[model samples]
Target: MGNGISNVKPSTERSEGGEHSNSSHPHKLDQFRYKVLKAATGKFCSKNLAGQGGCSDVYKGWLGYRTATPGCGLPVAVKRIKKQGYQGLDEWNNELRILSSFHHPNVVKLLGYCAEGVHRMLVFEFMCNGSLEENLSRECCREVEWSKRMEIAKGLARGLEYLHNMDPPVIHRDIKSANILLDHDFTPKIADFGLSRFGPQGDKTHLSTRVLGTEGYFAPEYIGTGHLTLKTDVYSLGVVLLEILSGLKAVKRYPNGRRIELSQWATPYLNDKNQLHRVIDKRIIKNVDMEEAYDFATIISQCLTQDPRRRPTITQVLHSLQHIESKHQHFA
Candidate 1:
């Protein structure tokens, strides 16, 4: 098992009214009936089960491309929360409220939702490529070449920049690779907003909230004091960068029963340009340009900086990634 621990503690600080605020209004999103989703997913058959999390089960479904009616046009993912699961009605409401308010190409699209009776479900555009976590595993790493990996990184940065630059700013409390899905073209889309919240507003430097997030992805400061900041996401982004570069999970356990955190294990190599190749995944290393790999390493190091304040903004990270892509023919 990889080091994916979910600390589902909700934040104590509530966001004020704004674009990022949890509001009752769902805007333009369709209100899908439970029956519609049930039919689309074949009554949540095991064969249609795309994936399962601690809180929900995701099933593959089909809907009309234009009208979004069941069993007609495009394939979709239907996420239904289990009763007495880790995530409850509150998370369902929060995800619906937040996602409905915003739309971005790099962020997953919430096509519709169902809140009928005791059921809660969300319908999203189907991602043919699945989660980045799946693609990066040893069995599938070959599918994602170095260029695709860099593009995925850029797309994630773009998504995070969009979230962080909102009117009141938004913080994705969870920002691991598993939450990042790849479309048919391998474009990365940030998904799952059950733990998202608005960023610190006005004069506040940070929000004192419950410590929550995946274990290996949590920032030092967040884990130490439960103080949340936009940089906390940056730290997670760094862990993702390390994952992309090394083709390893944020936490990997060996046959010896020893677990190694990717960020902690790769930091020394990330800091040393000459030794940067040592941390890169061997499968893609042959085609990797040393200079480009070094540049990517530099960005990862900045994001993994011990001091949260020292981490670069998501926008800056995007610019740096774009800059690297611009100069490299290595990125196909």
Candidate 2:
């Protein structure tokens, strides 16, 4: 488990229809001129800044439909690399390569890229609603109600299911809420493929790789042993679902100067149906259906199991969520 990954396989599946998915049979990726991207982002102005990562800064920009020129088509996010080191360049290339192969609705679309001189950037569809983590924060938690949370959860499951079912399969090493983007319609899209890796195939059970991901979202086994599997994503998904239900961050600092993981803090409420209310987000508490919430909690409990082998597959999780959604619709 030391980043000595090898024998990885790539996906050959093609998307039938999508905005950026309509490229070509061999996955034609757009190559954006640095000047064009700069113009689209108003010269990478601070006002257009959307996010900042350790190795890159993201700016919101608008480009032409066919030409991808400045301010004539659709809004997009431009992630510009700030570090030229090996690690930074590696992540950037990895994201570009991996995103070029994906065309799922629940996964973020890589519109194009810019690799000019010392500058390296990746362009993506700008998620209007922002990341799930941003929406769940204290300032905006109320905006995402009970139904929307369920929808987001299901969308995330679908995205993970698609990745897991790919030809060689993809393991999104980083699956935290911050990496889950939301569209104008609140459709959740899995983002940040910089740390993704191809999962084990055929006779292999798991891939031994370096452990890299958000601290709280790391699966127990992954953190301890660095064995990567599809179930690892499921465990991270459960942490995210817990955050959605409780309006809590994966890790938080308690008043006593100690930090606690959300799963450990919410275990009591998740384990006992009668105590579920104690952990429900106060902002959406009034609108939540206790029974439905309990069912959702049950699924989360199964996902958070320490034993990766015991966790339910993404498909199973999606089915359970769909069942809950159908029940809600019937009663409505």
Candidate 3:
């Protein structure tokens, strides 16, 4: 698609290598992102954009100035980082590197990137249906039918499986509902790799690093020890699965002073069929099958296992979801 950039000005000067010169200061790096945003939003107006993220605004654009096939235009999404935030050129570079390495149907495809002067931006295929967060959080939107939800979960698991089983293994340091986008058909595609990292090989149990993830989604072990592993991503995926099932925010601090994290709140109902009904989103209650609901709850339990080792591999998660989907084919 055609490239776009925002109007934000670079907060600081850029280095010869295209990265910000000030390595210690994060604010200065915001300049590069600002420039990139400006470039991405330059051609496409805000009206053409569909969404915005913590550090970027997403715009829908075209693949070429002129399409070879009429009405078959290639659609794309442009992500321009916010120049006023802590995100820097390094984060942009990391995303570019990781997305460039893999190509999977379940993973969002990185079309291209621009890292010139004080500008940094990433381009990807635009997901027409938007994020899972938008769909689940809305009260009047079309219900995420149980069969579709399972299909979405299976697609996400396959994407994560690719990341986890990669040579050296890529850990998606940030995995949440907002990062899981949906296609026109409502299939899930994993997005956002700015906080991701590649793990060590050859018997290394984990990669030690500073914890970086949404508050409630960080793995318990990673929070305690700062040890990054494939399991850490698995834990985050569990939180996402919980969100998909219960239609609750991962880190919702209720007014009752009871701070209910997804993992903590879902644990009690994980295996109890009677209690499982309480955790499901009320919107789809009448449409959901009881047996499939219990199976879905069990899958969430496996993913949210306290012991990282006990968590099912993404491959296993995919298989389980596929089984559930197969059982409910007629319902769709």
Candidate 4:
């Protein structure tokens, strides 16, 4: 991780050889990206397209020519950037730089980029299982079991650990269920690094000019001061953990004129055994190990602490999850 000063300001000059530097020169890879986009989407075939996000559309594609090994052809997902202003270019570059360099089993892999003309595109490993948000909120899907949820939590933590422990540490400004993708076997992978930033070497805090992220997941400090850090991701992860356990959205308004955040609503249940039953998802309640559930809840509480300094590191979080899983096995 790049540790400079606690409150060092970000440089106006973008880093060279990375996505940030390429933002100003769209001509460099515009044609290539366009070709890939066209090929991936079959001349922009709407049928093959998966979904559209705020700034880009994702399409399912197969790259028969590029094989990691013999007969191991590449099945990829292409993200085609929509035309916007200079701000859009920055997002493209950020995704490219961050995803290109980020190599982790739990992180979505960036195959390559198509940077042709005014169009920009990114190719990633296709996630067969789709986003975590879809599995949680969408109907007709099988409920995720406790063991599967634990696996997802561990995978996410491992991915975050990589970012937090980088030489110049990376901060995933956006960490939410919607940004987490799963593979064929339901393995979790962190996707979408457009809002990410590289923290200064040794710096505890980094200043952010713009406050951008999904509502209810932002860290208290980041929301109040516009400062970003590794802990910010931890806070979001905590919210995700609660959602996974309780089958609740991070921000939900109850019927009794009360709007409660997932973290807040679940906190009271973490410590009290009587309240624990109330916080768990109804689908898994009967089958879940009570001790395992309590342990997992405690870990989530630590991650969601209001004080950034108190939030457990991703490494610590992973260890806790692993311990809980082992404990569950022992009792089983």
Candidate 5:
């Protein structure tokens, strides 16, 4: 885990309305007919399952939102809440409450949901390219070129920036590679906001809750104290950025039987340009800009700084990425 940072202040993002407010952004929270979603997912067939997480199972589906007349259904990703306890209910409500009105090009859009009886399902635009994690797989890497990697990272940063700048900032408690989906054009969209929590309000600096997040990616402060702020999510994003550069999972066990955390294993090289070759994905080393790769490492190093107070905000991260993408020779 990264070292802890204390006394980090809440972001001063302009609060236009309270967290979960939908006054200005009045996108109707569409309620789906259980039958419709069930049909879309081929009755939740195993073959259609796209992926599974701690709280939900995502299945590929086709859905049409036409009310008056029938039309061609759009391909969709259906997230079905797994049965647990009240925790499941809370997560379902959280995704519905947050994604119902949250709209951004880089953020996944919630088409509708199924709240009938005990069934809890969320419908979203289908991402053709699976996830950033899948793309990093040896087989998939053949398709995710250097330029596409930078584009995905930049899109993820912009999504975070939008959430951070929102009135009553939204902290996407989970920001790992698996949670980032890619569309047909390889456009990135941040997903799985089930763990997301609002940023601290008024004078409060952080939200205190039970520690919950992917191992290796959770900030040390959060794991130790349950105190979460925008920085907590930023730290996770830093982990994802590092994963993108190195093509490794956040946690790994090398063949030598040495188990290591990605953040700890990659930190040293991220800070030193001279050791850049030691950390970059070998597949892309010959295909990407070395200096730009170093710059990205520097940015991730800043983000992974143990002290949350010293980490650059999402806006700054986005701008730096934009600059890199513009100048990097990814003619790949």
Candidate 6:
């Protein structure tokens, strides 16, 4: 996060755009000084633990005070990768490579990293508000206004648009609520690039890879045929959109005792005039416009389209949400 690495030894020469000219990018990224990280994170103490996933443990830390370049210190999230086989190694390296190259306001900032021997860690700006999932929990109320929700949706759509508009178009294979972190102002930042992949180029339409994502959020086609594309991410975002609207899990229990997926259960009533409210959470519906709800639901339905090609692009989604936001602001 400070001046370009001087204390930490370089693993290899960096390319013009931060990307390695070759495929081997694991060791080519900026490595942080181990001692600095230890001091910042209190040596990975449990009290500083922010969260843990299957691949890594995230610890909250501070930096810059001792470096003599800033006031007080800046908070950072240090993700320590858990030991695993070859596949885990690849995911770790992929996250390092993808996040290092990305620079979007809605994308988590990767300040630096530590890739010494068996140790693999990534340093990112700490999000004070935690994740979207925590903010949308059952305890939440008017704090998450309808306008704020729309802003979050727009931010997420913009993040996806950035990924999809890249040279080869990167696909964030996993776009669940938990991966969307929030800043102090509640602005959403898309995190977790370990499952990200570049979409096929030229005449190729899709890449056939092992389907990997949270259950109930996977696009039907991707789950059925393992065919992945930008639309695959669109479908997952649709499920998240549904969660934002309904305040329900991607898959939840209904009174009928069947576990109804947000997509499966909400899709049928999204356009039904008499049943639209059945799927929306009651918390913010009173404050939201019905016309806007229907429009938003329509977008969600289009994103969850069974046919990937039939789904709207991330750009389209962002435009639609922004238009809605504009109307709401003018009328407010």
The window of 10 residues in a row where model 4 has the poorest summed lDDT is 1-10
- Candidate 4 lDDT over 181-237, as tens digits, reads 999999899998988888755534565657899987988988898888788889999
Displacement of residue 218 (Cα, Å) in model 5 is: 1.0
1 or 4, which is superior by lDDT?
1
Model 2 lDDT, residue 13, Cα: 54
Model 4, position 275, has a per-residue lDDT of 86
For all predictions, the C-alpha RMSD in Å is 6.5, 4.6, 9.2, 7.7, 7.4, 5.9
Model 4 vs. true fold: TM: 0.84
Q: For candidate 1, lDDT tens digit of each residue in 148-208?
A: 9999999999889888887568899999999999998999999999889988889998989
lDDT of 2 by residue, 203-259 (tens): 999999989888898899998998999999999999999999999899998799999
lDDT of 2 at 258: 91
TM-score attained by model 6? 0.87
Query: Candidate 6 on 1-332: residue-level lDDT in tens?
Result: 14222233323533344331222222334468877787888888888899999878999888877632222488889988877755556677787767766667788888788866567788998998998888877875436887788889999998788788776688999999999999998889999998999889999989999989898899999989999998999999999999888878888876988786779978999988678999888887888788889889989999999988899989898888888878767887
Alpha carbon deviation, residue 208, candidate 4 (Å)? 3.7
**Please, what is the TM-score per model?**
0.88, 0.89, 0.81, 0.84, 0.87, 0.87
Top candidate on TM-score is: 2
Give per-residue lDDT, candidate 2, residue 73.
76
- lDDT for 328 in candidate 1 is 83
Model 2 CA lDDT for position 263: 91
Compared with the true structure, all predictions reach lDDT values of 0.84, 0.85, 0.75, 0.77, 0.81, 0.81
* Model 4 alpha-carbon miss at residue 126, Å: 0.3
Better of 2 and 4 by TM-score: 2
Q: How accurate locally is residue 162 in candidate 2, as Cα lDDT from 0 to 100? A: 81
